[model samples]
Target: MFSGAQISLYPMADDFVSVIMAALTGLDPWREALRIETDDISTLLVGPPEVLFAAMRDLFVRAAQTGVHCVLSAAVSRGCPGEPDDPICMAQGGFARDLALPDRIAAARANVGLAAVTGQDVAAQFSLYPLGEGPHMDEIYGCIDFLKASGTFDRSKNFCTRLRGDAGPVFATLCEAFTNFGTVAGHVVLDVTVSANSPSAR
Candidate 1:
C-alpha cells in the first residue's frame, strides 16, 4: 500500500517564515521513518499512518505554541490505485477490510481514546472519501457515528464534520477517520483543515 499526505501550513503572523521554520523541526523525529520532500507550495510526507499523523500533529502543535494563529491543510491518502506500492508505507496493525462496520467503529474509538493529550486546543473540519465501490454510504455513515462519539466532535456541517479539542485526540481522530472507514486495500482520501489560535475563536 502507498500512504502519504500533501500538507501546507499557514501561520497568521508577520514572522511566518520563522514560525514555519521552527515548527518544521518537529518532523526530525519522524524523518527517518518517512520519505519527506518540501517545496514552495506544500510538503509531501510518505509513510505509514502512525508516523504520518504524529508528525503532522507535532508540527502543527509547535506552530500553535508560538501563540500565532496557525492552520494546517492536508490531503491525506492511502492505497491509491495510481500510486505504486512503497515499503515505507507498511503499517504494523490495521483493521481488516472484512471487519464488520460496528467492529471497525469500536476499534477506531478505542484508538482515539488512547491518544496522548497535547494540551493545545484546535478546531478542524474534514471530509473522508472511500473511493471505489461496496457500501460507500454505509462506510461513511459508520464513520459519522464514530465521530459523534469521538469526544472531539463539534458539529456536522454541510459537506464535512467539525472537531475541536486538544491537538492529540483531534489528530488521532483524523487518523482514525482516514484509516478506518475505507477499504483496506482500496483508494481512500481525507481532505482536512486544522486551526489553532484563530482570532475568530475569540
Candidate 2:
C-alpha cells in the first residue's frame, strides 16, 4: 500500500517560528530515510507505515516540547483507487528519527498532558469534507458513522467529531476514514486537529 500524509503544524504562540522550526528540525534527521515535500499549505510525506508514523512521532514531540499549545492537522491516505502507485512508498529500510524510545510509544507519550501525560488519551477534533463526488453529505455521513462507531461526536457541530484515545488507534482510525471515503469517490479532504497536551486545559 502506498501511504502519504499532508500535515500542518500550528504552534499556539506569538513566537511560533521557533516552534515550527523545532518540529521541522525533527524531520531533518530522517530526511534521507523518507520523502518529504513542503509547500505553503502542508508538508507531504510518502513512506511506509512504520517510517511514516515514526517520523510523525518525532515531528510532533519536538513541537510539543516547546510547551505551548500545539496542534497537528493531518490528512493521511493509503493510495486512492485508480491513482498511479508512488514508487517511493514502496522503497523500504529507513532508520527511526529517535532511537531512545520505540516509535509508537514515543509518539503516544508525547501526546499527553502538561506534566507527565498518563492515561494515554489525546483529544482530537475532526471535520471530514467529502468532495468531488456524489452527494457530499452522504460521504460525510458515512465518515460520521465510522467515527461515531470509533469515538464521540459533538451534536451541535455539524460534520465534526471528537475522539479521545491512544494516539496509535485514534490515528489509525482517522487514516482509515480517509481510505474509506476516497476508495470509490472522487476525492475527500479531511480537516483534523489533534492536541496531545493543551496548556489551557485543566
Candidate 3:
C-alpha cells in the first residue's frame, strides 16, 4: 500500500464538504477498502494516494467551472495498517476551525487619467481599483460576507480590498471572477511585478 493519503478542500462555514464530497463520492465505489469522514474542523478522506490525488484535482477543476472561489489547504496523513482510525469526529462543530484567510488578488480598473498620460499606448504609473465592482454586487457581497464570517475576517468594512499575492494565482482568480461578472478583458490594465526577493519592494 502507498501508506499515505492527501486531502485538498476549502473552508466554509459548514466547509461545503458536500460539494467536495460529491466530487469524490464516486472515487471509490467499493467504499470498503478505506474510510472517508469529516468533522467540524477538517474533512478526513483516506484511501489510495493515486485515487485521492486524482479525485482532488478533479474537484478543483469542477469548482473553477462552477465559479466558486475556494482556498485549498492540503492534509497529508500517514495511516498504519494495523488499525483503522475511528471516523474523524473531533473538531469545531465537528469540523476543523482552521479556516482559510483572505487572499490578496491582483486586479486593475480602467484609469482614464493614466490612459491620457500614456497616450493610451505605452504603460505608465496608473491609478486603478484593485477590486473593481462587478455586475453582481450582491453575489460578491455575499461571498465577502461569508468570508468575513467563516474566514475570520472583520465584517465592519468592505471585504473587497487591494493587495498582492505571493504568486499569480490570486490575479488569475480575480480575472476569472471579473470575467464571470461579464468584464471585458480588453479594459483591464495591470502592471504588477513579481520578484522572489521582495514581492512588496521597489
Candidate 4:
C-alpha cells in the first residue's frame, strides 16, 4: 500500500513548495524528512502510504492549478524524509546523483539512455574526496576521479554516502540509509551503490 511520486512545478514559485509541504503535513505523522532537489527544486519526504499519497494528490491538484505550471510523475521510489526508516523492514532507497534527467531515469533503467550517461555502475566507476581538503575535489574533479579510478576501489571515503538496495527494496530504506547520511560517523563523502546482479559494469 506504500506509494510516492515526484513532481516539478515550473515558474519556480516558492509558495508551491510551502503549499505542498502543508498538504503533506496534513497527510501523515512524519517520521523523517529531507529536502529532495528536483529538476526544479528539491525535497525528500518519508511517511505512511496513505499520508504520502494524500500529499501527492494535493500537490498534483495545486500544481495543475490555473496559474501554477506543473508537470507531475509517479514511480517506485523507496524512501525519503517524510517517513523514517523501519529497521525491521527490508525496503530501502536507491542512491542516485548527477541527475541528467530524473524523468528519463525510468527510461535509463529500461536501458534507453545508457549512451548519454556514458557509464554504468557509475558509483563504482568513480573516486571521491572531501569538499575542499585536497588538490582534487569538487563536482567535476570528483567525476574525473570516478572515471580515472574505474575498477580500482570498492568505496571512497570523502563525502558521506548511503547504500542503495535492490530496485525493489530501494523505496523503503531511504530514511535508514540516505536521509541520515549526514550522521554518518565519518566526514567524507561515502561512495555507495546498490547491491544487485549485473555485469562487472566496466
Instruction: Choose the strongest candidate by TM-score.
Output: 1
Residue-wise C-alpha lDDT for candidate 1, range 39-154, written one tens digit per residue: 98999999998889999999999999999999999999998889999999998656545688899899889989999999899999999999997678999999999999998999
Q: Model 3: which ten-residue window has the lowest total lDDT?
A: 118-127
lDDT of 4 at 29: 33
Show the lowest summed lDDT stretch of 10 residues, model 1. Answer: 91-100
Residue 123 displacement (Å), model 4: 35
Predictions in order: lDDT = 0.93, 0.61, 0.32, 0.31
Model 2, 1-99: lDDT tens digits are 566778898888998888898678878777776788999998998875445655665687777766677789888655455456666666353322223
- Give residue 165's error in model 1 in angstroms: 0.3
Cα lDDT, model 3, residue 14? 55
Candidate 4 per-residue lDDT over residues 16-60, each given as its tens digit = 556455434432433343223344453433343323333443443
Task: Tell me how far the alpha carbon of residue 144 in candidate 3 is from the true structure, in angstroms, after superposition.
Answer: 37
Name the candidate, 2 or 3, with the larger TM-score value: 2
Query: How good is model 3 by TM-score?
Result: 0.31
lDDT tens readout by residue for model 3, 1-202? 2222334455232546565656454445425544556566645555543334333334444433333444444443323334354443111111111222122111122111111111111101111222334444443543344323321222233323333321223323222222222222212222221112222232
